[model samples]
Target: MTVELMATAEHAPHREEFAALYAQVQQFYAQQMRILDADADGGEARWAATFTEDAVVELPLLPAPLRARAGLTHYARAAAERRRRAGSRLHHWVGMLDVRPRPDGTLHTRCSALAHATPPGATSKILYVCVMEDVLVRAHGTWRTAHRRITRDDLA
Candidate 1:
């Protein structure tokens, strides 16, 4: 007889289930980083779609957390415009992800993220090194960020 195991935050995931979850989480981050890097292409709307409508984002540089999709979109637009004006490009790299399943069915994740900036005729320079903690919810068979907190190395 075969038995199936269910995974939860309090208990370990079955091998097959854990592998699938890991892949999904990695793919989500890959897509998110790509959208963020495409700042010049007006990708903010597409990027914002990856988050829940009522998602909250906290950044070390901002005094207040960005609440909802509207706030997130505004921030993305402003950052894109700033990069455009400065003739620079920004790239985001995320690694060392720790993903765990929450009891409520949300995925809790923490990752190290690095922001690199490249100016016209200049080499890329590290702008910020941050730790990103996120709560991801499965919606419509895909993952969406419900909440995120970014703490910069300099500030932390």
Candidate 2:
């Protein structure tokens, strides 16, 4: 009976499961960025679809103490709109490097990204470069960002 229980220590299968879950979550993020990039008129609608029904967004104006992911989808949509209206094109995305699971089943993720925007008659500018720190969760088998911290590197 002891010999039969020896296989319990194997973590290979557990590792595979986590990888699959991570990939699924990443796919959702990729789609959200794509929608924001390709969409001209309906970008907000498409981007909002990727978020949880009760998602929050924080702008630079918010007091640090007041910043919270307590349902700021409307504000995020408006911010996206402001960028869209000002530019001919904007592309922003990240390459994930690490993901760790929290005790509550959320994932803490780290990723590097390069963001660029080009106005109609002006040269494209690489406005921001940095790593994104995210708290992610899978709801209904889909990954949603519960929190995001943008650490921009002005020198990058």
Candidate 3:
């Protein structure tokens, strides 16, 4: 079962309703980023669970789009290893979110995403600045990403 999101807060017919939905979406991103930043056992799986089973992830750095949870999990695991080898940890910070309710009941969202890498005995530095767009669907009482596209500033 999916809940249809209301319009954006600025022009919403019901301000309270939109505000609640906005808070839920914000919390979703917070939890998702927390899982992505963690380097504990089952962290990959936890991060993968933030997306839908058939989610698609597209990145300019990748040769091909990663399809489904399995592909996403593999990518997360590999990325974790690369971070480990570099002796750095990555933190994904997202802001300036613009979310609109789609006619088909999904939400179209875009945000500024910044990634910082912190190495042992070194201060964190910005590694990537990107624009992330997502097609979000509400299912099982929570929002899950159905599709994600990342456009890095350096690559753009």
Report how far off residue 49 is in candidate 2 (Å): 3.2
Give the C-alpha miss distance for residue 117 in model 2, angstroms. Answer: 0.9
What are the per-residue Cα lDDT tens digits for candidate 3 across 1-156? 113332356456577766777777888999999999998868998899999999999999999999999999999999999998898989999988777877788888888999999999999999999999999998898899999999999999
Q: For candidate 2, lDDT tens digit of each residue in 1-156?
A: 133222321322485666665576577668877876774665666666665665554333455421333234345566677876775678887774466666787877777877788888988888788777777777787787666666667743
Model 3 root-mean-square deviation: 4.5
- For each candidate, the alpha-carbon lDDT, in order, equals 0.87, 0.63, 0.88
The worst-scoring run of ten residues by lDDT in candidate 2 lies at 1-10
Worst-scoring 10-residue span by lDDT in model 1 = 1-10
Query: Candidate 3, residue 27: CA error in Å?
Result: 0.7
lDDT of 1 at 77: 89
Measured by TM-score, the strongest candidate is 3
Question: What are the C-alpha RMSDs, in order, of all predicted structures?
Answer: 4.8, 7.2, 4.5
Clashing pairs in 2: 56-72
Best to worst by TM-score, what's the order?
3, 1, 2
lDDT of 1 at 112: 94
| Per-residue lDDT of candidate 1, residues 32-149 (tens digit) | 9999889556699889889999999999978899999888988998899898999999999998877878779998999999999999999999999999999999988899999999
Error of 2 at 28 (Å): 2.0
Off by over 4 Å in 1: 1-10
How would you order the candidates by lDDT, starting with the best?
3, 1, 2
- For candidate 1, give the lDDT of residue 137: 99
